[model samples]
Target: MTETPETAETPFDRAAEFDRQVRTLVDRGYPSLAGVGPEAFAAAVAPLRDRATATTGPCDIDGGRIPFLLVVARGAAPIEETMPRTTLHRGRLPGFVDRSFEPGSLERFVVPEEIGLPDGDIYLLLDVERGEEFCGVVPGEAMKTVAERKRTPLTIEEGVALVTHFPEVLAKNKCFSLGGSRCGDRRVPALWISKRAPKLGWCWEGNPHTWLGMASAGGRSAG
Candidate 1:
């Protein structure tokens, strides 16, 4: 009998793939992800692996419109010319504790502290940008102060990167390249609905990968 390679056995070129996806998004008119409802948000998320099983819940707050989830192709790479610190460092997000998130309540979309929530929350996982910066909140675990690589969900920066790099004053819903001057790609935020992995850690899920802004996501607006 011959042994076959596992489906995931082959490593993917995450960075290259991410760049490709961004390019595609640019060609597609940069649709806005701001006002989508639960059903629509559900459709945005990337599905879990066939063998994998997990529940997803929607973050359908703000009446019906969806919030933004920013992403970048290269999050973990050190600050450089092509990729600048302004993007890796500056840029605004919504909030740490979701506005709709109740105190002491736990949900996949809610922060991972002060409460435990029931199942069925959608946490989108982008296929590209494996090493980009981002994170996720476990169902009911105490959020560790620091990430332990693969185990923690996403760093605030990675998630911010996904956000259309925008200035604090501008509240329009669009996905601008972190370094728009260089990338010259600006579109509505790329939408990816996410689900909670019961027993899994951040690394295993493979979200935006970066150590920036790991201390606490409360630095600026992270809503």
Candidate 2:
């Protein structure tokens, strides 16, 4: 079968790529979580729509062409609520919080002061990488590697956003850790395929799981 130009994969098909992202979010009910309807939420993202790009290939530690991810800030849509919306194989997985954390534990896992994030209810995460290489490395060692490469690790919200927008990226045996957000402790939050569904769980920082890597991005921009 011959592939038409529209059907063929391109690195930068601006309009089609951006529209697909908008549809993905709307389908996953991100607009409702942001206190807006699908149309309003998409309109809010229109100003930055032209800047959207697709992840055509792999990203390296030094940086590469990573896709731009549309993120609803944690403040706007809490992880607990957004997580359950995540789906895999038509099944919804609960966003399980580690029992070690208190009831309000998520609030304590704020974006580090050093990482200056965009100020808004919604924004664009540039050069987002799934951190496949860091899979076998411990969270502690992965942090050093991420820092050495001049990249910021992803927070819990960003992790949810990544999986929400790109479900195929959260494959079994290739889930990732949200090492960016921490509560001054060693517990690192992660998203993995649990019981054939996507789950938000945590792992110890010093421990290395062969299936988990640390997710990161180059930086963030206001949407």
Candidate 3:
């Protein structure tokens, strides 16, 4: 049978490819997560599946496409907004907002509204030297919750508490085991060999940066 163009598999679909590896991690454990393969994430994000934004191009981290959504929530504001203090960095992964250097430092972003995103939207987010930050979304409000529109970045502890309280978002990973790069301390989530999944090792601090590093989704999926 011929696969529809919409359903056809491309050679380098990164998100689908990573999802496939997650299934493999499950297969390896055969019903025991052992702290890896964050499959519960799938169920948590289910409410927004119909609301996911479509893209024909690959994700910046993987250079391949996946079903991850770009939120454009309803009643979203129409102005292009950005965090005035946010710093940019070049790391192996995409979607990272370079700010936090220590475990207690606060990283920040404007909600979809300020960015003209549709209401009630969610998307994949990545970070270096830290656990992945996908749950940064606030369900019913913009992330910046001040009348003046200024947010106090959540302390790492505070942020992790809210996100991982569900048992689905194990974002305690600071990736500090992997030392910082000469450029900076950027790392990604990782899986270990002893069956403790998502152990968080390997640094992205090297020259000749490849988009796919051990911390990146593509490199992890390919591994």
Candidate whose TM-score is highest: 2
Instruction: Give the 10-residue window scoring lowest on summed lDDT in candidate 3.
Output: 214-223
Between candidates 1 and 3, name the one with more favorable TM-score: 3
Comparing candidate 1 with candidate 2, which one achieves the higher lDDT? Answer: 2
**What digit string (tens of lDDT, one per residue) describes model 1 on residues 1-223?**
0112113554333333333334433322222222344344324333322111221222221111111232322222211211222221133222222223234221222223432211233222321122212223221121232233223333333344333231221122211111111111111111221221001012212133222112112111111
Report every candidate's CA lDDT: 0.24, 0.75, 0.24
RMSD (Cα, Å) of candidate 3? 15.9
- Per-model TM values vs. the true structure: 0.21, 0.85, 0.23
lDDT of 2 by residue, 1-223 (tens): 0111232353345456567778888887888888899889988988777556433333221322246778888777888788887776445564454455678888988877888688888888878888878888989999889989999999888888777766667876778898888888888988888767787778999999999988888887774
By lDDT, highest first, what's the ranking? 2, 1, 3
Q: Write the per-residue lDDT of candidate 3 for residues 1-223, one digit (tens) a residue.
A: 1111133353344345334433432333322322223465344344433322322333322211222322111122111111111111221121222332344222222222322222232233222112222123221121223212332222222122111211122222311111111122333222211122222223232321222122111110000
List candidate 1 stretches off by more than 4 Å.
1-24, 27-55, 61-70, 75-153, 165-223
Q: Where's the lowest-lDDT run of ten residues in candidate 1?
A: 175-184
